[model samples]
Target: MSTPNRVYLARLAGVAVFDPNGDQVGRVRDAVARMRATQRPPEVVGLVAEMPMRRRIFLSINRITSIDPDGVVLGSGTLNLRRFEKRPNELLVLQELLDRRVQLDSGHAGSVVDVAMECSRGGEWALSRVAVREHTGRLTRRGHLHQVDWDRVHGLGAVGDNRGTANLLAVLEDMRPADLANALQDLPDARRNEVAAALDDERLADVLSELPEHDQVEILAALDRQRAADVLEEMEPDDAADLLNELPPPEQDVLLDLMEPDEADPVRQLLRYASGTAGSVMTSEPVILPPDATVAEALARIREPQLSPAVAAQVFVTRAPLTTPTGRYLGMVHFQRLLREPPADLLGGIVVNDIDPLRTSTPLPEITRRMATYDMVSMPVVDRNNRLVGAVTVDDVLDHSLPRDWRDRDAVSPSSATHDGILDGDDE
Candidate 1:
């Protein structure tokens, strides 16, 4: 007996199907898998074969013998010519599994780029593994495939069943918000929004902050106006402004009206900045504190789990009752300086004037240079009145510097491009 080797689904889809007599009967169209109760990989139930006259038939694995890269060879001389009909518990691999988004237990997610199948010791061909590609774009389609065990994927074998959805969610529940966002974007539109709806406002806001503008808009549009407003409230002013800018004026106005004034004000100010300026991409909320705040007080604010890593590294010192657009921009104190200072000492005495602040109107290139020159991860932005209005984090600056519309482009040609007929829902 020839040992079974793995074959790519894209290459297998159109391979010839032959009977024992060696006469070609049809072309392979798709594979059918039956879900099992246990953790073992799902079993390959049959193959959907397209015959002459455009007639399609289901060839149960029980009837056929070998499935190899060359073609499928049947064990019997006579073939079943009955038209193919999908059974309720059966999953069409090409139509439902391949190229579909799946969540992994590793707190990561990606599309099923391809499948690996092998003939078992018992002589039946079954899916052995799947290739999940994280990046999808012009350059990434031809990219490296991260092969994982077939059992790790959710949303495949148990199609349309609660088990699969539950398993998928279990893997996603603890995923980093940004990682979850990447996973969600790769899912089919309906499934993507379904998952997005399940995330809490704060969690969803964090995910939205990591998503591209187009995806951010799509997810927000999918949400109810009130929920969208709540999520926007949880997002940073700059990220929220970026999302709002992408919406039509009428919709934007409606959403803004639904938001609390305090939350909407900073975003409104950010929306006023021109597209490529400092004010355009700066985060209006940084960790600000009064100059008179003791080192102990500063440490407490830094300890808040909600503060992003970049914002937590430094504290902006402003004149009297610290607030955005404060009475005056005094100076800033780095977190390292705080640990060394006496707990009772005031921040005003420890604040450093070493780094220069960027004006709201500073050009994008100049702002980029300033951050790079000072090796600063977060830089303060001041208005004409010298009041601190925002701070631009390095991540945001890099995002602005990237090619426009980069997010909207695919990382690779879609997996379906190679075998469109295999993906046709009507066929299953």
Candidate 2:
């Protein structure tokens, strides 16, 4: 192999993986290592690479002919295509070990910044070195970064707890919220909570909404009550309500009490509606406007960077009081219609109400059928008095429609069943 003797795992992240023909296959997501019961260094086994369509597959160390900052070259193009599942004795270097709090043999306390795997002359690779950053409680002065033998660190044997998340979060900063949430699922319970708590409220809220409900509740429970409530505030009201619904009523009341009343109100309203109803799944904060609002104004509102594509696809035009439960709901104007109309044109003229709006009590199946039939990205939900209460997006419907464990690691992904690639091992 032409690979370097020692390579830091963090630097390998995002490096492209290619076949013998040099065609790009996937990118490195994490490295897999087999752990031992003793203090011996862990053996480097393989890599977890995310292939097309977000399918993560394992590539055995023996299949690689080269490894560098540029890319990892596979000896063969055939990939097993099996979704990577961590064995009980295996550790995911980047996911579980980065930022691990450790105690050096010399009595210095620090956290892991990176781990390096070294290849021996005898043709075996093992985790041999650790880069740790010292822990300094002061904010003004920076801590020293130390490079030491892996055996010198005390905490790598177990998953990290109370570790700094700066290094791990930096690697994940570029990931989309859904991808980040999926990555979070691969981490150990304590490590997941640490990373979740470290994220800013808005980022955490986005990630939380993408996670499975059980994982969402666990991470939330691990946070400080005040912090958790703040994160809930940052999530869409529907998402926030869905997460809260996973908890017991008493616990939900505590978090609700901590949130700002305005943010809590919509969530409370969502909670009152029966499960699987439009009212329970709709977002109370969809783009809303009065019929008199101009096309340009509607365009500008939807253009806000914070709005999701589905929510921004259209605008709900209602009477006085733009907030939910506002005066009579007039109708809605899709962004496409807004673009066709003159900028000065009033939304009232172009507003579309030909398709009747969904009532708060509409069941999930009916809402799904209507949205699909109308080819709508979002549908407005009105109360009995015709007041705009909320709007449900296609994403909401899909989230509810999927099996509860759809996000679990064991869940079968679309491409998981294929095994076009060779998974040859010595035993096989």
Candidate 3:
């Protein structure tokens, strides 16, 4: 067989560094690239050592002669260096990162357990986020932690550097609402609810909307009426409607009554549509711009703070008259299409008229068929009068279609076929 490809130094950053004899030589720290005179790839340059005071040592990429699942073997018998340099402003050491807190963002937190490096990113390297395991109680219980890519990490800070007495909850509390929501998904139900209750109305709303339907129900059921109402008010109308539809009729009515009229009205309107129909599933929160508006103007409108959070996808351009009580139905303007075209292009010119709008009364199966045929992720819902009602996302359809028989699998007899003889013999 031909010689295998030699793994580069940059790819070996987080790889377990070992001596030629297979003795562990600490993990590869960070890969450093030095600019070269020619346009060729940067030299393997140096390695930020994971051990011996987290020192930085220079090593040639050619030094890494082999790689295996177990560890890496250096071409040289041992890594020898005359001198090493300390990374300027480097506060974290590999030992410290092993069990220390790294703030993913202001609201999200996790303990660093291991760093992973992508061997394929040429010479580039990245830090991988891993959940820290902690022991508790007299029994010395341990729990699993989540792993997230470092790219998703918005910020990083050190927590509990001294010892194993870190407060995970306090660190998690500092993360942003969005990041916190993501982090909480990995928490236990009781702990998740506790964290949800601890957040303010806005943060609670974010977390609730981000949650899976079952978890959302649990959190909402646990919240007081006022808090539930506040969260519902903050949610997109379609999302609010879907959430309310899951609740008991009495509980739903109570929460609806507590919400502001403006906030509750859209949800009520959405509820009038059939459960899987476009109107019932559509979000009333789309960014609607007049047909006459230029791309620049539409962009400006999108940038405005007053726009709903639901408008992140696209700006729906309707005939100015259509926005009124008697306005007629018009086409749509997707954000991607808008960005690709010239800025001077009129919103009307860029409107995609081929999109098929769905009626509130349309059957869900038919809607699903159309979605599959068109490969559309979301479709607008309208009423008999062509009034924009709500939007249905592909995810909503998939969620609805997912079989509820998940628990039924456990009820099945594992040996049903083989047990038939036993049953018959017993009857005899």
On lDDT, the candidate that comes out on top is 2
Which ten-residue region of model 3 has the weakest summed lDDT? Answer: 415-424
User: Taking the tens digit of each residue's C-alpha lDDT, what string does model 1 give over 228-347?
Assistant: 999999998888888999999899889999999999988888988998999998888899998778999999999999887888888999985466777689888889999998999999
Candidate 2 local lDDT, 347-387, one digit each (tens): 99988889999999999999999998999999999989999
Global lDDT scores for all candidate models:
0.75, 0.89, 0.57
Worst 10 residues of 2 by lDDT: 419-428
Would you estimate the TM-scores of all the predictions? 0.63, 0.88, 0.52
Cα lDDT tens digits, model 3, 115-164, are 44333335332233344443334355554455565544432332333333
**Clashes in predicted model 2:** 1
Best candidate according to TM-score = 2
What shift in Å separates residue 211 of candidate 1 from its native position after superposition?
1.8
